[model samples]
Target: MWAVRRASHPLRSQGYRLGAFRAASTKSSFGHDVDCGVVVTCVPGRKVHVLDCHSLPLLSAARHGKSVNGGYCLWNRGLSSQAGTESSGEESELDDGFSELENPIADTNLEAKAGEGEIGEGLVSDSELLSDDDNEDDAGENELHLSDAESEESKKKTLSEFLKVIVAAPRMKMDAALDKWIEEGNPLGRYEIHSAMLNLRKRRWFGKALELSEYSESHKLLDFVERDYASRLDLIAKVKGLQKAERYVEKIPESFRGEIIYRTLLANCVVQMNMKKAEEVFNKMRDMDLQMTAFSCNQLLLLYKRLDKKKIADVLLFMEKENLKPTLFTYKLLIDTKGQSNDISGMEQLFETMKAEGMKPDIQVQSKLAKYYIHGGLNEKAEAVLKELEGDNLKVNRGACRALLPLYADLGKADEAEKVWKVCESDPRLAECVAAIEAWGKLGKIKKAEGVFEKMIESWKKGVSSRHYTSLLKVYANHKLLAKGKDLAKRMVDSGCRIGPWTWDALVKLYVDAGEVEKADSILQKAAQQGQTKPLFSSYMTIMDQYAKRGDVHNAEKIFLRLRQSGYVGRIRQYQSLLQAYVSAKAPAYGFRDRMKADNVFPNKAVAAQLAQVDAFRKSALSDLLD
Candidate 1:
């Protein structure tokens, strides 16, 4: 093990916005001087493997560079992108598979008060962040500016005392506690204040993080750097809406308003899938002559890949014009996009090109290729990839076990999945156990899945997180094992599992899949009432689609309306689900076309087909004549 050493290097010396509290003499709220020592977490070659998503390193680029996917990326389907946090045990696994890192906020006293729902509701309101009228320059007092260099908060508190102060009351704004901490003779260590904000963000507590940031800025706490500015910008975009973030951006001193700041904004737009805004930001970056990096290009690619695969070629053409060499991530996006379109030949060609360019396919890429091949009915190719992924020794290459299990199960190779599971069954990691449960669930082995979960509970050193529980919850959801799902959910509650959007999404799937759509809808409503965070967009989609499929137009319409009210107004899934509900119910959806146009959403072929089928259940004059 590498021994911890002193990083006595000054914060400003290292170019970080280390704040005014960086002095070693800072006292804690307890009135004791603390060691403002860095943990020296500069471990080389360390990789944070994401266990799951309501978790990117998060599906943060959501299917694309969706929001914070901010941890070190594991091989995502396309390419691994940059993320900085490790996964906490408490995350609920989202459907999208990406690699995440372990939670890095170790042994810190960043505790959350029970039932207060410290994190903000997930994916709230991406609705037009800035309207045509809320012009950029007009944002008034909400603007972000640099803090005063000698802010008093920085003078009073120690790092240890500061963490306790902020986390002591997670539900309320941190401003008062900070004031109280200062009043108590605590010297704010720049390290403590910054670490507190970083930990809160990792915990997915965007509102609290924003509150802390606001406090830091309003009190003139630290001399802000460009990265510090970018971090705050991300927090604002997440908490206050993108428009507010943009408005705040207008006040940023022009010197610091470089590509990183614009790129941060660009990412938020992509997360919300605001293609128009994303493009505008990109164009602005171009106009400013800011240097373009793989990140911005990847962001555009992710957006177009999801919204209009047709526009992907245009993004590629632009990249080519700029002479941008594709990174592994860029290739990952292109290959996945191609595979998704069922252009297997194109996908293969791109894979070859990546090889020709000397970018080796890592495990994640090979895993992704297996997925495409399996989906494409190229079982032989998939098997080859899986075998290659496993390599010679199962123990040495146990990391591939998680990826291999699901892919094998998807191929219906129960024995092969068992073979992979056997390798790790003796001493499995949390991720491996979760994967085994999913693989077994897919293979229809409920007992085996349960058995593994039981074993995981007994063996997992950190205790089974709600994230760990989420894997089995998904299995139960997939098999429509309502009773089992309910039992496990109760077990989770009894075990005091921290519920977030991920768990909420799983519960919705459980109820909806088991023919308990109303119950699922009820859970969602109740969750909305309790959690500071909104439910996932997919959660809304779950209920809406089920309602539509059941021909429950009233409920479907209500959910569709609720979805819009919840700030997920931009997604086409709800619109389609609502239209499909009308069609299924044999009801004419009058003026639906106008509604679509109003929202800037147009009908795709599937939605149009649905519309044609439901457009006139009543005989219109033209249709009557044709008949």
Candidate 2:
């Protein structure tokens, strides 16, 4: 990555510094591929102007003349730099919101470029994507605890020179990128580093982002404040694991160990589904006498919404006792939890209460309401919510396309889905394109889905990342187009796209659907071994379900063990699948009750039914061998 060396011209003194970089697909030593995107500048006497580095105007500056404090060159953050786009560290990984410009999808840099697009297309002035990636209040994970003014200044940081070199390769060594950036005489303002890291994290390049943060830490690149420390802890949790993050926390100054820092740890614990640890961290926060934050409480709500429903009320009680007002995410969790339990009335009451308290529902809330309505067989209510979501202009609301596509598909409204697709097609983004593919696939239009996927390749060209490929791969997997799925997988490998969890899940399904269960198992095991990415919990369950169907008792047992070893310990689906495998083999599920008990998994009626079937065959210890 050849850093665009210092612009030696006197224009540098005039504060009209120039920089150029290309964004493209590239591989890195960091164990994943990345696409770069960042170009925000504050010119002399102009409101902060930010445009994508890959925009036509920016690329023009890179190739030809270089003098765009306004149009052609990068601007220096002199006395008047404004807050650029900030992708704050996220606490909850759930999809609970959407809107006209924001998608609740796996939006990476390869997709829409940032969380909840706060700036308009082409050129944005004064508008700031100050929103972090959090589902709760925008307090986000960085918990940098910097004063608001300090954070605003940090948001102004934008790296102009290095991205040019970054365009030359898919990815590079983190140290190498940073070293080259410094060698070229780029200013390592703390916030500019934040901007670069924000761009990288928005693109889902966690590995590279962590390397940059680590470099900043070791080099003392910026003021090592609580925010930087907290942000790095969150990154370490993402790139390495909880253990590494905790170890790093040990080295922090005792004074710097604040609420934001421990809350960051609690968030990661919830993400890993480590219930015991999550509770311990929550209690630790109380023990520290830190004022409980809605963000931290929301993290628990997210975890309980996934694991155990009964515990949700207890959290609500705690919130009431603490006089904590529910955040948007808190309401979202309660509404969703209520809806999933088929408690439609309760869901409505919670949503109404949210509005009664003047908490306006955004596109995300409406989309979710429509989703639950459709799921609960209330098509009229769902349509009413959908129509309300479209508001006054379906044509203008591009963000609704993603939420609408699947909701319409589930309702069997192909015509409606096509209408949503039309709005996106007029000027498609990567997120919209991916949604169209999934929607078409769901509607059983493989040809249309394939056509959408191809057009995506044509539009983005080399801008496509492995993250985008997962959507279409899933379409193929769902359709049982094994050959097509295999070909796509090969293309992904050949193009050197990052193979993360979603792709791994799709690959497993591809072989599983085609009766190559063993092959699917191997793919999952290998992905786990590489340790570059964590496999999704669903990916493991997919293989186990197939093994049970085939009476592959031993394989089912093996996968259940693997799942536990990987820290996916509390799910009951694995237990059910293992019991089914034994029943299919006409053999006893030895110690099945004890196994569930150990995992803290209590049997529901369905699980109890499976247990009864398996227990009937519990003849003797020798019966563990065969029927």
Candidate 3:
């Protein structure tokens, strides 16, 4: 046996290194002369070089025999030295030259494992990891001068740049970026494909996310794992709604129909409020005999909690029968259901049960308790719960702070509200800002509310939403800070904010308080003409109520007529106000009740008493005229 290595070759410079080969004189089955040297072919990214034992013998001979698979054994040190691979973190070991160049042992082992049915679990095909070399020769035969390390570094740079472009590119340019990636002829590595999809998903660019997923599948770049499917399902639910999510599930073959897919479908059902569909999914899982896990049961329980709390008993019984252990989330959900039903005792029992089960209540549970206490008007209990929550940690949760703020506002506990605000003020969320502002505004702390507004403007990355602007405007409107209120209203309009009904009512109240009825009427008229958004019925009601209280019944009737013309059928309260206006003016309102009835609006007790008073007064006036 002889081992041969070529010292110099034109092909070596072209990125192709031919390893040593062996020759034997044994006759073969075909009965031809058997003295030709075996060829060891080495193919790089493109070109291939074939080495013959007789032509190149630059190294010493080594022991040789038939390989395990009955092929002549030959070794290649150069190919063995390479640790480069297509997948991130996975190293591909080069086989001896005796193995076929196209058939690496890594691939063979992967195939063997797949045949044993472990493919989808974690196994990825080499074809997906490595670039397709079947069409390599057809792809122009250019010699790549980059060494292994240099090639890896270049690839890392390319991936990094590609990720940056994808992330920073506008939604409109995402497709172009993907096309550029393909045009660059750089094979996308595993990390590149996964990271790109993840980034697209995070941006909620559903179309681009699906496009990248399809691109990967079409190009055989990476196999779609469970996470990929989950993300795609999430995109479908978010962008295309529940129907599309259902269709997506149908398209998935039965092999991929597992607990993960069902869980995603159930979550979408929850979001879409399709309770029946959620139940159907649970039934399907049972039909498939999929193991009833606590997670699946919990999802089902959430659906039940929203729709019919009585069904929660069924879930508990099912869990007991199935021997599925209940998680902390399950117990917490039960606690919430009890709290919502006002069964405070039941809720407390569940809390005790959770603790007995070694499920410690976290900040979320404490906040829930605080909310329950607030709902029941147990202010002291609510305060105690909040204090316990605060003592638990110096760094309070934003949600907890929001909950505490609202409770403080409702109870008129401004100092406690301020303390909660201070804890979350350093790094506040939009919700936290809104809650703090509202709490201070309710407590009649206009200055503190304004301070929070300024902080909200300065800190939130996305500028304040119209709702935030309107929230602050309410403070200005309530306090009759006419100068500031007028300026802010102009800013809101100039900034293209649709003034909320509360803000509009506040402004009208400010005008009425100032005895500027004409200005208030003009504001309403301007709001009506400004946009397709008609002023809310309450805006007109505010002005009518103001006019009625001032005994300006004619103006009140005019506003009422305008409201009816604007497609607002008067409700009981509005009708009562109108009737009160008639009583103030002593106008005959004989057919008004009939008209209200025609609109399916019945007069309340207050309107009835007003009508009776009018009737008795008319009878008395007639009697006097007869005398």
Q: Encode model 1's per-residue lDDT on 276-385: one tens digit a residue.
A: 68877987887778887766777776665444343343344344335466677667766665455444555676677677678898877788788878878899998998
For candidate 3, the per-residue lDDT at 102 reads 16
Model 3 clashing residue pairs (backbone): none
As a whole number from 0 to 100, the lDDT of residue 560 in candidate 3 is 79
Please count the clashing residue pairs in each candidate, in the order shown.
38, 13, 0
TM-score, structure 2 vs. true: 0.72
lDDT of each: 0.62, 0.61, 0.55
Considering TM-score, where higher is better, how would the candidates rank from best to worst? 2, 1, 3
If both were scored by lDDT, which would come out higher, candidate 1 or candidate 2?
1
Deviating ranges (above 4 Å) for candidate 1: 1-94, 99-162, 169-197, 215-221, 617-627
Residue 605 alpha-carbon offset, candidate 3, angstroms: 22
In model 3, which range of ten residues has the least summed lDDT?
A: 67-76
CA lDDT of 382 in candidate 2? Answer: 96
TM-score of 3: 0.52
